[model samples]
Target: MNKISYIRWFNEIGIDDVPLVGGKNASLGEMYQNLTAEGVRVPNGFAVTAEAYCSVLEYNNAWQSLHAALDGLDPDNIRDLQARGEKARAIVYGCQLPDDLQVEILQGYAQLKREYGETISLAVRSSATAEDSPEASFAGQNDTYLNIASDDALLDGYKRCLASNFTDRSIHYKYDNHFDYYKVYISVVVMKMVRSDIGASGVMFSLDTETGFKDVVFINAAHGLGENVVQGTIDPDSFYAHKPSFVMGYRAVLKRRLGSKEKKMIFTNTLNTGNIAVEYTKNIDTSSEERSHYCITDSDVMVLTDYAIKVENHYSNKAGSYKPMDMEWAKDGLDGQLYMVQARPETVSSQKKGNILEIYHLKERSVVLLRGRAVGTKIGAGKARIINDVKHLKDFQPGEVLVADTTTPDWEPVMKIAAAIVTSRGGRTCHAAIVSRELGIPAIVGTENTNEVIKNGQAITISCAEGETGTVYDGLLGFEIQQTDLSQLGHPKTKIMMNLGNPDQAFSFASLPLDGIGLARMEFIINPTPRESPRFSHGEESGKLVLT
Candidate 1:
C-alpha cells in the first residue's frame, strides 16, 4: 500500500478509498469486495490512482502552466475558457506516463487478461474525484472509451480519460460549483468490457426518479450500448416494478412503455486503406420488431428488479438508512448473464423529505394543447420561445416557456432563465427533466413535436399538477395552489419542513405552523447583494461578528 504505487485492484478498495480511486471506481470496488458473494456480478477492473494522475502532471511540469492558464479566467467568456481548457488538456494529453506508472498499468491490464482472456476488450472510463457525490453528480461530464482491445488503445484511452477533466462542460461545472481545478484529480478505471453492444444495456434507479416514490424501481433499456439511453439519443423501453408487491411474492411489474428505439450503437472494427485497424462505435438502424418490442423479457425485468432491491438493501444496511441507488446494467448476449456496470448514490429524491404533498388544481378545465411526461407538480404560464439551437438561446426572455428538441449540460445557462420547458425528446432522467426538477420548474418532456407545435411569442400554460401527464395549453390558464397541511392534525411523528429559496417569501411562510426550514438556499440571498469585504467595528475583532 505504498502511496507512490499508483494502481489498485477493485478488490483492494472500497467506498472509503474515494480520495484514492475517485467515487465511481471506489463504489465499484465497494461492490466488488462486499457484494460479489451475494451473487451480484460486477466486471473486474483496476483503477489508476489519483496519485498516478498527479505524477503525470508533476513529471511534465504541468501544474504551474495549468494554474496560470486558469487563474483569473472568466467562465462567462466562452471562447477564452475553451481556449484555456483545450491548452491545459493538450499539455496533459501530450505528456507521457511516468515509467513506473506505465508499468503498473500494463501489469494491471495483464492481470485482467489472465483472469478474463488475452484479447479481452476493455472499457476505460474517467472517474473524477468529485464525481457521483450526493451533493453533485458529474456522471456525464467526463468521458468513457469502450471496446478497447489492444495495449496501445488502452494506453491511449487512459490518456484521453485524464484529458477529459478539461472538457468544456467539466470545466464549467467545476467553476460553477466552486471546486478547485488544481485539487480535483482524475482517476482512470479500466474494466472488462461487458459486450453489451451485442445485447441490451440501460440504466436503473432503485426509486422512481420523477415522483420521488421509493416504492418502485425504474429502468430504461435499449439495444446495444447503454450510451444511447444515457445520452437520450434514442427513446428506450421503460419499466417499473413495485417493491412492495415484489417483496410480497406478487412480482408485480406496475407499468411498461415501449419507446421508438430507432437506432442502436455497436462497436465495429474497420480497416483503413493502409491496413491499419481501428475500433469505434457505429450507429445502425434498429429493425421494426426491435423498435416495437421491449428489449428485455418480463423475466429479465424481474431479475433486474430483484438485483436493484438487493443493491439497495446492501447499501442501506451499510449506511444504517434507506439508500436509493442509481445503477447501470447490461445483459451479455453470449452468456445471457446480467452485469452491473456502475452504481452511485441516487442524487435526487433520496435527499427530499416525503412527509408533505403540495397539490395544484385548475378550477376551470381548459383545452389541453399538448401532453407529455410531467417533471414537476406545478403550473406556470409564459410566452413560448422555440429554440432549436443554443445560439438562439440569447433571444429567450425570462418568464418564457422554452421549446426545444432536446438539451445537454451546455444548455443549462439558458435553461435556468426559462420559466418552463417543453422538449420533443428525452425521458425523466434526461438533462431537461433533471435540470428542470432541480430548478423547481414545470416541464413536459417527450412531447414529440413541441417545438413545431408551439409558436414563438405565443402565450402558453404549462400544467404538471396532474398525475404523470403534463399538459401545455394554448392560452394563459388560472390555477389554484392547495396545501394539505399534515402538521395541523395531532402531533406529527415526522418533522414537516419547507424549502425556502427567496428571502421575500420567508417572512410569509414563517407564520405557518411547521418545523423550521429544511433548506435555505444561500445563493438567492447573496447573489443579489453587492460584493464587499468583511468589515468589523472597533470593539469587535476581524474574526468576530457583531449583529445590529
Candidate 2:
C-alpha cells in the first residue's frame, strides 16, 4: 500500500478514479476490475497517479514558468501556438521525477517485469483529466508511447507523455473545449503491450459508427497495431455483427469487407533508423497475400462482438441509460488471443437523439468510381482536390472534396472547408471520420485507391446516404433531400409488407405506418459487393429493418 502514492494498479481502480488516474487508465482499471470475470480480456497495467504529475512539477519549481509560457496564447496564430506549446512542454520535459516517485515507478515497472518477463514491453499513455472535460470530448490531447522495454526507456517515455500535455494539438483541443490549462493534470499509464505487431489489432464500437444505429457492432481490423486503422493509415477489414441475432445463436456476422491492409506497424529492434523519427515501432509494407486474407476469423469477430456488447451494457448500467462504447482490441500473435486494450464511452453517436431524419435520394445513378467508410448521413458534391502533403493545404479551394491518404486533427482548418472528404485510409473511428461527423461534412474513409483513382480537380459526388460504405460518383448527379421530424411522426398500424433494398431508406421508413416486416428478401436487402454499405451496408435478414 506504500506504493499507493505513485502507482495504482488497473485492477484496483475503477471509473470513479478518473480524478486520480485520468479517464484512460480509470477505464482500463474499470474493465480489468469488472469485466475480466465475465471473460472480457483486459491486459494488466498500473497508473502513475495525477498527483505524481503535480508533485514532479512542484518539486522542480517549474509550474510558474509553465503557466507563464501559455499566458498570451493565440490558437489562430499557427507560429505563436507552436512556439508557446513547445515552450510549455519544454518546462515539463526539463523537470526530473522526485526520488520517491522515481523509486515508486521503478517498483511498479519491476512488478510488471516479474509478471511478464525481464524484457516486457509496456505502452506509456498520457491520460489528461479535468473537472468538466471528459477524455473522449477532447480528441488526441496527448501522445502515447508504445513498445517501451527498459527502465530508462519507460521513464523517458513517461516524461514525454507529461510534455505532450502542452503539445500544439493538445493546446488546440483545450482551447476549443475551454478547459483551464493548469486545472488539467496528466497521468502516465504504463501497461503491458500486446504483441499485435506479430498478429493483428483494430477498433470496435458497440453501435454503428454512422447513423447512430444501435442494433449492430462495427469493427475495423487490420494487420499489426490498431494505430494504422485509427490514424487512417490502412483500410482495415470491416465487419458488422448483428447483436440481436448473435444472442439467438445465428450467423451474427451479417457482413464482412476485406481491406487492402497495405502496411503493418511492428516493433523496431534498433533505436533510431535513418529518416524514421519513431523510436519503438516502424511501419512496413504488407504482402499481397497478407492484404488479401482477413486477419481475424469469424469466431474471433463473434467473441469480440459479444465482449463489445458486454462493455456497452456494463457502461449503460452505470450511467442509468444507454451508453455505447468505443473500444480498441489487439490479437496477440504468440498467445493467439484477443485483448481489449482500451475502452471509452462513444461520445458522438450515443448522444444523438435521431429526432431529425434526412432522406436523400439519388435521382440519377452514375458509374461508381470509389468507395470507403461513410462518415455522415447526408450527401455532398464538389470537385475533388487531392492534397498529398500539408504544405499544399493553402492551395485548397472552398467546397472542394478533400481526397488524401489520411487526415489528422491538424487538417481541421482545411477539412472544414471541404464539401466532402475522401481518404485512402482510416476506419469510421479515425480522426478524419470523427472530425467530418462533428463538422457535418460527408466523408468516404478507407477507400484504398482514392488517391490514385480520384483525379485532382475532378467533379465528384460523395454520398454516405447509401449506407455504411460511402461512394464517390463519377459526376454531380441529381439528388433529392426530404427532411422530416421523426419525433412528431406516428407509426400507424397496417398489415403492409414493405419492399426495401437500400439500407439507408430503412431508417426513414421505420417511422411510417407498418405491421412487422412480411417478406424481407435476403437477396434484396443484402449488398453482396462490399462497396454498397456503411453502417447498414451488409445488413442481413431483418436486422436492417429493426429500429433501436
Candidate 3:
C-alpha cells in the first residue's frame, strides 16, 4: 500500500491492521489523525509505519520458531520461559533491516525534525497490536525510548522496542491473557516526546476508583513520569476533580508525598534503599522541573470537563453503543490543554444487579475492635478460621470464615474468599463495617469480648443484617434469600453488609435471619512491619464502646 493509504488505513482501523501498519505506526496514525481531529493534542511525530515492521518480521520469520517453542512450554516454569523469551528477543533484534524500511525510518525522523524543529528531543515509543486496548490496558508492556538525540538512535530504539515485545513481563502478561501468539504483532509510533514541566505525568480517571462514582475525576500525579505514579515508587498527589466543573468541588488536591528531583536510584550506589531502580532514575532533567502551578485548578477543570463531555457525546453517537464511558485524558503542560487518551464502554454497566454496588470515598481503611449482634444469615458455604493479626491471614483458606480481633488494610485477598466476618468491637463507621458493606458479605461487629469465644478454623455463624437482634447459627440455619432493607428508602436496591474485628462475636448470630454482607473487612491483610495492636489501658476492658 502507498504511504498515504497506509496512514489512512490506520486512522480508520486502529490496531486491527497490525499486519499492515504494525502497532506503533497504527497508533501514531490514529492518534495524529483521528484523536487530533477529535481535539486531543498528541505532540507531532511520524510512524516508520507497521508495514515496515511486518517486512522485518517476515524477513526473519523468527516469530514462527518462537511460537512453536512457546507452544509446549509450561507457564509455571519461569526459568524456561525467561530463557526462551530472551532468545526470541535476540532473534528479532538480530534481523537486518531492509534498505527501503531503513530509508523510510530515517525519512520519518527527518519529517519529525522538520515539523517539530530541532529544539526539542523526540520520544520513540512502541505501540504493539495487543497493547493499549480498552479491554486489557497493556500499559508499559513494551519498551519506550526517550530523548533520542538523532536518527540512528531512533532506528536502534525501534529495534530495541521490537525486542522488548518478548520481555519477561510482557511475555507473561500475554500468556496469562491468552493472546494469540502468532497474531500478537507490534508496530512502532515515534512521537515528539513532550518535555513535561512537572518532571512526570500521570493518569486521571474520570471517576472515583474506590467508589466508582462518575461525578469525580481522580487525578494521580507525581514528581516524574506516570510510570512512577502507577508503580507506587513514590506517593503521588491525588486530586478529586468534579465533572463538568464545580466552583469549589472541581479541584481538590491531596499531597501525600513529594519526590526528590536530585536523589535518583543508582545500581552502583553503596547506600541501598532496596527500591527497584529504573534507568530513568537519573537526576531530574530541567525539562521536567515542577512548576509553581497547581497540579489542577478550578478553571482548568472547567476546561477539561467541557472537553470530556464533548468527547463523550461524540463517541456515544457511534454504533453498537451500550452504556456510559470511562475515559483517560492527558494534558500538555505548555499549552495547558486536555487531550483524550482513550475511551471505553464502562464494564460495570453490564454486570448483574447484585455486583453493581456503589463505591465510596474513604480516607483509608483502619483497624478497630468493634461490636454487633450476629444476624442468623449465611450466604456462601465455607470453612472457618480465626486470625489474630495480619501475618496470619494467608493461613485462612478460600471459602473459610475469618474471625479476627481487628483487621488492618492488608487483608484484601482473604476477604475476597471468606464466608463471613464477626468482630468483638466496632460499629457501623468502622473499617469492618465499611468493607462488609461493600463486598456483600455477612458480618457481625461490636459484640463486646467476642474474640475470646471463637477459635481459629472452628465452625461458627454470623448474622449482620438482623440489626441489633441478629443471631449466629453453627450450621447453615436458614434459606438464602436476597433482602433490600439495608438500602435507603429511595435506593431500595442498595446492599449494606457488616465489618468486624473479632471472632467470638459469631455466637451472637445463633438466631434471627439476615441478608449477606456488602463487604468483608480485611484491614490488616498482611502487615509488612509488625506493630503492636492498640492496647486497652488499665481498667479499660469494660470501657464504653463510644470513647469519643
Best by TM-score: 2
lDDT of 1 by residue, 90-109 (tens): 88888888888888888889
Deviation of model 1 at 118, angstroms: 2.4
Residue 271, model 1: Cα distance from true site in angstroms: 7.6
Q: Compose the digit string of candidate 2's lDDT tens values, residues 309-398.
A: 899899889989888888889999989999998888877766666687777878888889998778877889999999888667767888
Candidate 1 C-alpha RMSD relative to the actual structure: 15.4
Question: Which stretches of candidate 2 lie above 4 Å from their native place?
Answer: 1-4, 130-135, 273-278, 362-369, 382-385, 392-400, 451-460, 473-480, 495-497, 503-548
lDDT of 3 at 95: 83
Arrange candidates by TM-score, descending: 2, 1, 3
Residue range with the least summed lDDT across 10 consecutive positions in model 3:
262-271
Instruction: Give the lDDT of residue 341 in candidate 2.
Output: 85
- lDDT against the true structure, per candidate, is 0.81, 0.82, 0.50
Better of 1 and 2 by TM-score: 2
How badly does each model clash, as a count of residue pairs? 0, 8, 68
Per-model TM-score on C-alpha atoms: 0.84, 0.88, 0.58
C-alpha lDDT of residue 279 in model 2: 67
